[model samples]
Target chain A: MQGTLSVSVWRGGEAGSFQSYEVPRRGNQTVLDVVTYVQRKLDGSLSYRFACRVGMCGSCAMMVNGRPRWTCRTRVSRVASSGKLTIAPLRNLPVIKDLTVDMTDFFDKWAKAGGVFKPTATRAEDFAAIRPTDSKRRHADAGIECIGCGICYAACDVVAWKPGYLGPAALNRAWTLVNDTRDGNGAARLRAVAGDDGCLACHSQQGCQEHCPKHLNPTAAIAGLKRAVAVAALKGRL
Target chain B: MSAEKLQTCLWLVQRISASVLAVAVAVHLITIIAAVQGGLTAAEIIARVGGNGAWAAFYGVFVVAAAVHAPIGVRTVLQEMTPLPNFFVNALSALFGIGLLIMGLDAVSILYRLGGG
Candidate 1:
């Protein structure tokens, strides 16, 4: 590894260009650490957003070498192509500033996809027993770990092609909720996700699956929705 | 039907028609290959299948499947590639489906009527 690393970061909002900076390379340094150095020491005006500095927050994901990745977990040595790095805001989103895209659309779509769980029973009732080994529980377990990192959403070609289309994160969350037997919103949730720009719009390209840090498959969830929607269509319930 | 319901209905139509087309295409190909290798002339082929109710019914099903299947696929492509709204896409899909239905059924009828004994 060289003593100095050359970094090129997107320096402004949607219309801006890349700005280069040189930082000292050190052992165990992450991409976030490099950005911190340039911002704290070299240029205070350079803007970015992060909170936990760990992988749990899912707020530090950005484009690294033209691929969306969680920069908090991404080590500099692993992704520094040609001894250089390029960092930018996630694609297919409205860039608010350097390395930060507005998340309103992402969260709004999640709501539109029925991402929230609704309780089927009132608080007066006893706690519902959910067997972990049950098929629905197993199905939900396979897709419930999404951190809303927006990496999968950014990686999705469907989102890029159609602005109105619900991206992968929202669809994945809908799939999990759809599997939740305790959730009382099955009919409504299914309706929400079966729209023209909902789960039915997914092209099954698996870009979301390939880029997901949680290893969850939104494509599979979408396939489930496709089957469910078809059944609903046949029954005249859709 | 509501727009959302129509979209879902089209999705079902596309999938079901594709399954039918799979069988139709395979049977059609195998029959063409067998008849050609057996030195069946156009007149001979027509004499065998022409005016046959069973042949007419089979081809009728093929025409229906293709008519429904082709339009939905094109609609999806057009929707993804262009900025056209859902209304325009639906309109295009309906037109394409109607056009395919008319042309395909016409061809099926002509083949069944040929060399009528």
Candidate 2:
């Protein structure tokens, strides 16, 4: 709501530079507002990805001041230090352009970890009546709300090191799928996540949990995955 | 080995070597720092190593442990950072571990025989 805010936005792909922009401050302004203003008014070439202007879409994630967050949810008032902010694309992914990372690798790791729900019963069969309060359902409930945001992925140091590693979000999704009573592929899923680049590789740095906007504990989910895999391996099913 | 078994092996080795190296390096560094701080002469150092069989044995263990430890760390770094072929990476790290053992033993020998400590 004052003179100007100093904004440094990443301008290229993986190898890029931060271009500085000055925008007039406004009240209750979100980080996405700042980026939008700079792109629409200041410079037309600046590129960033976002769908729903609200926080639900999870597409507006960027590294703001060295931490990945949803720009739509993160207010400038909360993050701006000395009225300056640095915005860059999510880390550990190939940057397609400024503030946009190619999520193919991230999503591919999800599939590799067997995140997809493999139903045990056909629709012709009776519908599975899973009590909402059941232990497995509760466990799945804890992680089922993930918005596919790459914030946790960007915050993870292990992913940076092991490029093949299935990241927190993917592993979290797998955990939910594992707990689904209808899922028939639990043993196979456990096998897939038991390998070198899978659930066993997580160092439990808690970076994913710390930076997740949804407050989802992917680390805990991953720990459960590890236990599940170990059990399956011991049982000779994995 | 199955991928799960391989991962388990790596996890076990890393922890075991880390525990061994922690004690060895701590004693080594503390000894060096204490010697320097006390202004102990080279002759005094030599006399201790030459006469103290226990100290020689301790250092021998330290050397072997370090040899086992450092290469595993380097191997982890290589695994994380580079796109080098897997077989070559494992081979090179094994060679490095062996090299460390040879150098460590050689140094211990020099300390015991030539230094007369």
Q: Which candidate number maximizes TM-score?
A: 1
Q: TM-scores of the models, in the given order?
A: 0.93, 0.78
Query: Could you tell me the lDDT of residue A40 within candidate 1?
Result: 98
The deviation in Å at residue B112 for candidate 1 is 2.0
Model 1 DockQ class:
medium
Q: How do the residues A27-73 of candidate 1 rate in per-residue lDDT, one tens digit apiece?
A: 88899999999999999998887889877888988999999998888
Query: Which runs of model 2 end up more than 4 angstroms from their true locations?
Result: B9-74, B92-117
Candidate 2 is graded, for docking, as acceptable
Native interface contacts kept by each candidate, as a fraction? 0.76, 0.34
**lDDT digits (tens) for residues A1-238 of candidate 2:** 7778999999988878999999988999899999999999999988899999887888999999989989998989999958998999988889999998999998898898888888889889998999999999999999998999899999999899888889999999999999999999887788778876888778899999999999999999999987787666556666
- Model 2 per-residue lDDT tens digits across residues B14-57: 66778987888898788877766457777777865754668778
Error of 2 at A101 (Å): 1.6
lDDT per residue as tens, model 1, B14-71: 8889999999999888988876755768777787678888888888999999998998
RMSD of 1: 2.2
